[model samples]
Target chain A: MSPFLRATLTIAAKDLRSEFRTKEAFNASLSFSVVILVLFSFAFDPTSEQMQAISGGLLWLVFSFASALSLNRSFARELQNDCLDALVSAPIPVAAIFLGKALANYFLLILVEITALAVFALFYDTHFAAQLWPILLVIALGTWGMTVIGTTFSALTVNLRMREVMLPTLVYPMLVPALMAAMTLTTDLMNGIPLGGDNLLWLRVLTGFDFIYTLLAMVFIDIVVVG
Target chain B: MRDRIMYVLATLSAALLTWNLYKIFMILPDEKNQGAIYRIVYMHVPSIFTGFTGFFVALAASALYLITKDLKYDAFAAAVTEVSLAFASIVLATGMIWGRIIWGIWWAWDARLTTMLVCWLIYFGYVMLRRAIDEPTQRARLSAVVSVFGCVDIMIVYKSIEWWRTQHPAPVLSVRDGGGMGPGMESPIYWNWLAFMCLASILVMVRMRQESISREIDSLRRMAHAY
Candidate 1:
């Protein structure tokens, strides 16, 4: 494997190992997503016709909020012992470090999204299994999009005074188009809309967004991380 | 010489905007379909035009700062972003007024309006990010990263109408698709675009001066602490 890929995997493994062992942020974000899923039913009648139409929006909203909650912790742990500075000064490439952490974030967020989807299915009686491949496709694309921007901005605001507040404030707006695409696609999937033809446009948009942002984040991550 | 140019830009924009206002209100007649409500286009279109211009400029300035490691470019980027945010606010306010009158709604979740608002929020978050960081180099580096990252939305905002073509009108300014205005009515929008640019230049100049002074103060405090 290329050194860059190796470095990224190593960092991602380190993060996943540490996170899985303690499950501090993982458990918090998972619970956050599940709780929001349950609370959403109270916010609106989940059995209503309108609720069926908007279930996708509600699910993605929970995923985004919970992901932002966890992404902020990606770098917060490094700050514990001035570990961020030490990591930056190490011999590994800066972009690799960003990718590794983003990869780890992607995995954690995916797990949260899957659990959230299961709870949503159980509560709302939505039939996602019939469109399992399409739904998973949307989730994978959308979650990667959110994880990329979230991880980069997590590093961006990690050194700030009000990072707890700043991270979501910054991440949420940037998350819109990706999250919107995700929400729209998810809604259509839940409502039994076909995934190709005219829907091809949204798929293109989601894919394009994921590609462009990942490249931009990688190019700029060095300045944010190493500076 | 710089001061002279500022004066010239300020005087020209003020005069042109006055003439433009009169022309829009007095010279131009109401549209057959929308009547007086359409006049808000003069403000709404130009404000968003200038706002987009400022965002791209900030993007470039941020890229330049990253390449040169120059504090001046960072400050320039910050000033342009903040001033452009003011222009973006005008766009939202005027667009809402026009929408309320023409479409009978204050806002719509249509692609264009929502993406425009997303751009506004992203940049506002940019300003908030800058305020949270105290270290000069770190602030410059990190915020420049974000300035570039946030600009990805501007592209999405620009294409949203073409992409979704829902409630928002198509490219009226460019005569694309079935979406052009009466031949001469659009002249005012183009001229006002220039006027808003001049206005933005004046504000950016004033803001950049403040940014420079703040940088100096920041350095002085650092020096004092060192001593």
Candidate 2:
């Protein structure tokens, strides 16, 4: 295998192994998401038609916050054992480190999201039809964009005091467009709109955003890591 | 002395501002639709221009800092970003008031407002990023990368608004085609924009000087402790 791929997978495997051993990050994010969803359920009249109308938005909100939790711990874990400095000294590309962390975080986020979906379905009488695939597609692309951007910022802020609070404050606002696109697309899909025309236009926007931001993050990762 | 030069610039800025305000209120004609309230445009448009100007200045300073490895340029960039954020907050507040008068709502997720908010938030993140990192080199380099990315993000935010075709008013002030403003309205708006730009420049310079002196004091204290 090429050095880049080898290094990327190595770092990713290390993170996965460690996370599997402790389950600290994953458990926290998953439980926090459930608590948020429950709060949303109580805060709004779950029986109101308005709840159904806004379920997609509420789902995205849960995912956004939960993903933030995972993103923070993704890098913070590396710092806990002085592993980040060791990783930096490795003879591998820094972009690989970013990619590896992002991939792992993406996997964990998907797991959390799926579990949240199951809970959302049970708590609310929302219907899901053949539109599941497109909704999932939007979620995948949206999460990719979110994770890439979030990983970069998390790495940038990892060494700071109060990073746990600062990371979300810094990352969430930048994720607005992705979140907006995801919510809009998911809402339409839930309403059973055909996945064409304006809906496709939104999907294309999300796709373009993912491509551009990922590339941007890759190019700038060196500045973030080395600095 | 540097203080004298700054004071002269400040006096010029104040004089130009006074003249511009007089022209906007006394000389400019009332709009057919907006009546006297349209006058808010004088402040709104100029503030937005100053905000963009401050961002570009930050971008240039960031680039210079990265190229030269100079802490002074980094301080300059950060200072400009801070002032720009202040200007953006004013723009947002004034825009909301104007929107309330015209659109009958306190907030609308229109293209211009939405994009402006995103742009503001990104720089807000930029400022917080600087505050989070303590090492000067790390702070300078990371902030440089951020400022550069932020400049590009601003463009994306602006273009997304146009592409999505949301309810924000179309750009009423573009250099292309001289912004299509009537001569009656154009002159005062142009003058006010110039005055605001000058005011923004003065604020950035003062802030930059303070940052440089603070850094010097910090370094001297560190040296004293080492002895």
Cα error of candidate 2 at position B106, Å: 2.4
Q: Provide interface RMSD per model, one decimal.
A: 0.9, 1.6
Judge the docking of candidate 1 as incorrect, acceptable, medium or high.
high
DockQ of each: 0.87, 0.68
Cα lDDT, model 1, residue A180: 82
Q: How accurate is candidate 1 locally (lDDT)?
A: 0.88
Candidate 2 C-alpha error for residue B207, in Å: 0.8
Query: Which residue pairs clash in candidate 2?
Result: none
Model 1, A42-113: lDDT tens digits are 887888899878988988888888887789889888998899988898799999999999999999999888
- For residue B46, give model 1's deviation from the true position in Å: 1.4
lDDT of 1 by residue, B151-211 (tens): 8788888777677757876668655655568877989998999999999999999898887
| Candidate 2 CA-lDDT value | 0.83
- The 10 consecutive residues of candidate 1 chain B with the worst lDDT sum are B170-179
Q: Least lDDT summed over 10 consecutive residues: which range in candidate 2 chain B?
A: B173-182
lDDT (Cα, tens digit) per residue for candidate 2, span A151-216: 998888888887887788778777877888888888777777758988777788788888988998
Candidate 2 error regions (>4 Å):
B174-180
lDDT of 2 at B36: 88
Q: Top model by lDDT, which number?
A: 1
